[model samples]
Target: MDNGKIKHIGVFTSGGDSPGMNAALYGTVKVAEQHGIRVSGILKGYEGMIDGHFIPLESQQLQKTVHRGGTVLKTARSERFMAVDGRQLAFKSLQDNDIDAVVAIGGDGTFKGLIAFSEISKIPFIGIPGTIDNDLAGTDFTLGFDSAINTAIESIDKIKDTAESHNRVFIVEVMGRDSGYIAIHSGLGVGADAILIPESGEDFLQLLKKVKDYRSEDGFIVVVSEGDELGAELVASKIKELNPEVDLRITKLGHVQRGGNPSAFDRMLGIRLGAASVNALMNGERNVMAGILDNQLKFTPFDSVVKQHQLNEELYGLLKTLNT
Candidate 1:
């Protein structure tokens, strides 16, 4: 890590907003200010970069921010930023503002934009994992994952009361269009009778068997990830098709899981990684991501970081055995 030419750095959040993003942003601003590196908040992520939406940042701007969810700077996914000209325009704006380095907080799409932008601009970029999906590689837990699982658990717990009262089967759906971290953890936490995730390879038939096995029970819960190849709706349809006499319902937690104050673990992770990103740039590291691997802080090159697998097989197995 030897390229510390950064005098001023711009920070932004992009892609889907996560609960701990503001905590990370606060960490970056505070640490950068202490080191005498001028800081600017790039509004709406890359769109702000292209549009020149920058606001001077100091510790005061971040006061009382650690307890908040989403990002103080806000976030967005930019299609224009995906184009070469869009990136060039963003670079020109950075130059005009005297920004020398950048730190972005978000998930895979966020990193992809940073990687492409860094390729054409001398200004180095670093990424901080900030999504609740916990699907990205290189880190054990993404910033908002713990908070999201807890939110889902709370919602499902209430829904369970209805299921029990009506003596009906409820197939609850949680987020994870590509990954099942939310489903696996929240389902297990609430002690669902069964859980169905895309990666588990537990097909519709397997789920059908679980439903039947638990038929003697008064009521039961089945947790399903949205990305499950079998699809949650199809699972419901099939169940009703075979067990016509069964009373059933479906609840999709939706964006509600994305809200709520970040959990303690997420706050610590966001602040630590946020500070680490600033340190990494000062140490001359670029085109990398700040990650916590095996409880140790590390800087992984963005290319390799995004390619790593994130599923926790050990927990998945425990969910299956214990829930039965």
Candidate 2:
């Protein structure tokens, strides 16, 4: 697609909300303006795309949004977008608005939606990784991973103080369904006695063994990913059943992990990827995700982006070594 031909661009955040999504909008609106391209902010993702919820954006209005927790345009999952009829409506909306191209801020499901829709439509789409899971393949860091782990770490640290005072074993559950990045990073950051993630393939016995070594510590914290085979409840039950004298408690850090100001790294990453998405479109790139690998911008075609990024075995090893 020629930049001259691409006069209007539509941008939206889909699925889960992340800390840096607003900053991403800032970058897109600002950069697209420089290229003489009009940006239409689509509300509520694919839902808005089908309903024709288009709003013109200006850089000046987005100045203070860089540090915001959630997205300015908002985000949501659309069951309708999964159907052929729903996508047709979305396509008609774009055509009606004369949108030349689009940028999507979201994770696996979002990109997959673009690919599926493309089979029946002609509009080009470029994506920016925005999920907290950090599970997208190719990107070294998704938009909110840093802020999420930082949030998890801060919450875990405070929980430690309480656990230490009561001489209790606290089993904390964090998000990242089927992925361990959040649990691993937060657990390691807070010096958790044990970290249980789905990738570890570790059973409760193995986890108990790790905790045994640090049992005498003032506060015992075990970070378990929601995806872990033995979740916080099971772990708590097993531990309490095995040792009746041990005081144990369970805490599920739910949506709290998904909210907060974008961390320094996340702010930079979000804005950088956002700007890169517009640049990619201007350079005639589409059906790909704007990502950072080795601290440099890279694009992975939707066909190449996998469901899950491989956890760095080396980082996992480091997590184990450092905790010991």
Candidate 3:
């Protein structure tokens, strides 16, 4: 609760790795330096925190990382960190290193872990929404969502080329385990014929009818989020059964969407949110996530941010209208 009690800040990325995470780390380091606060890089997220994997980071260590993807400090999912004993160990590690606070970058799972850790330790914690899913409740857009959508769009564009050449229906699957943000945005961006998301349960018959309607067209593209009711495989199977004579292919754009240089928007968002996280901690904010909502930076309680994000119905309707 005392701002002066925080002299050294620890930062780490956990859960799924995403683009622009390094930019966030860089921004945190640079801003902490400006504020004369020491920065310690916690390698491999909470696992590192438990093992006391501490490294002093300067502004020089963050050189040229803005354009880079992934985290310079690395990331991991720690089952051990979930236990009370493990959290105690993590707190001891922080105390041993003289780290008074933390800036964590990752998705909902990361925040959940931070909340658990906070119950056992007094170190203030600030979270940055750094996930491709864009499924965090507090933020309008997460740090890596923009770059991830762009990556999927680029891959969809390439698949469209071959789909057209072969006069085939390509079922393209994108990441977003429980949300449709990536599928909706990339689907609209690539002008897909139909888009299936987890939020709107897949209607196989409806999809079949749409494909049949577009049969005479040059080619067809259906964008499906991996978490959809009918995944790419099942959807493709149903389509094949309905139209055995139709040329159909399935393309799952897996981890590729999580890599590559972050887009301009993501880089800027990461930097801004990263700096905001440090400022929040210095201002005595704890157990909150730093994010941008309505183009303004803000902090939300960790409990609220970790809740399941509702799908944007307006954007879903726009996708339908545009596709139709």
Candidate 4:
């Protein structure tokens, strides 16, 4: 609606960092240039927005980074961005720089920022889905999910090696705030004997039953989500009571899953989604998120995109039955 003459725009990654962020930045920059738009990349997520931390971007600034992992633009969660004063400051910074629009690359929390931001400034902004959790509602898949899942699987595989050698029950803990896509996919990918997730919580006794049945003199591998009902250490202790002879260990994958080179799938998807986001902006879709909905790529308002959504029930049930 603005005649596609976007003079200046901004890009920032808010919320947790993940692989493929750099690719998204590259895509956004390249596509914006194609439309004769001047783009600036923001660092440290919304903190950068509040502090006016921006690097004016040119196509050369993002050339050939499509295969790289992590956000070259950098990221941070601004607790500041959540407040009214902070949000106002952020808008001031954007205005000071003459930014006509913004592209936010992050998950639900970041989209919530978009909602607040649009209400305050009425400046056009588009969201590019980049969270590894894949929990964002509007999109079929987020950009970083493939890389994160691969990282989780690799961690589980390595932990299993040690578990088998020592005949110990290894509980590999992965990151998944609420949705269990990562835990479930990684568990099934690596054939984890017992997988625990927040969505499918059980009391200690019930959990013990599953662990007991899956445990053996040869040891076992149990995969747990950080947001699971109980910590892996506590779960291991409970199993120890059921079988005193069983050795146990826990591998908290921690931020390691957020590290490393992004998988090819993530990079390419990030590029396409990033470019599509800019196109969405050109199409007069502001304060919206660009994502794959139903089978086609499209845009949705940030508020709608950030709505609380959960894992596929069918997949959850399948994982439960398979684990049992």
In model 3, the runs with Cα more than 4 Å from the true position are 1-3, 322-324
Off by over 4 Å in 4: 1-5, 202-207, 213-217
Decreasing lDDT order of the candidates? 3, 2, 1, 4
lDDT of 4: 0.82
Error of 2 at 89 (Å): 0.9
Give me the displacement of residue 323 in model 3, in angstroms: 5.9
Question: 291-319, model 3: which lDDT tens digit per residue?
Answer: 88899888999999987778887997886
Task: Give lDDT for model 3.
Answer: 0.88
The backbone clash count of each candidate, in order, is 1, 0, 0, 2
Weakest lDDT window of 10 consecutive positions for candidate 1: 210-219
Clashes of 1: 1
Give a tens-digit lDDT track for model 4, residues 1-324.
234457788998878888888888888889888878889888888999899998888767676666677777887778888899999999999999999888888988888878877778978888888888888877888988889999999878888888888778888889888778888899889887778887876434555776664545555777788877787888888788887766777788988888788899888778888899888878777888888877688788777787777779898787767665
Write one digit per residue (lDDT tens) for candidate 1, span 176-287.
9889889989988998878888776744556677666455556778888998887778888988887877899999999988887889999989899989999999888899
- The pairs that clash in candidate 4 are 44-76, 45-76
Superposition error at 53 for model 4 (Å): 1.5
Give me the runs in candidate 1 sitting further than 4 Å from their true place: 1-4, 308-310, 319-324
| Candidate 1 Cα lDDT to native | 0.86
| Model 2 agreement with the true structure over 1-324: per-residue lDDT tens digits | 236768999999998999999989999989988888999999999999999999999988986899899999988899999999999999999999999899999988999999998899878899999999999987899999999999999999999999999888999999988789999899889988778888876445566665554456487888889988878898888777666667788999999999989999999898899899998888888788999999989999887775655778887787566545
Give candidate 3's total backbone clashes: 0
Model 1's C-alpha root-mean-square deviation from the true structure amounts to: 2.2
TM-score of 1: 0.95
Go through the candidates in order and give the C-alpha RMSD of each one to the true structure: 2.2, 1.9, 1.8, 2.1
The TM-score values for the models, in the order shown, are 0.95, 0.96, 0.96, 0.94
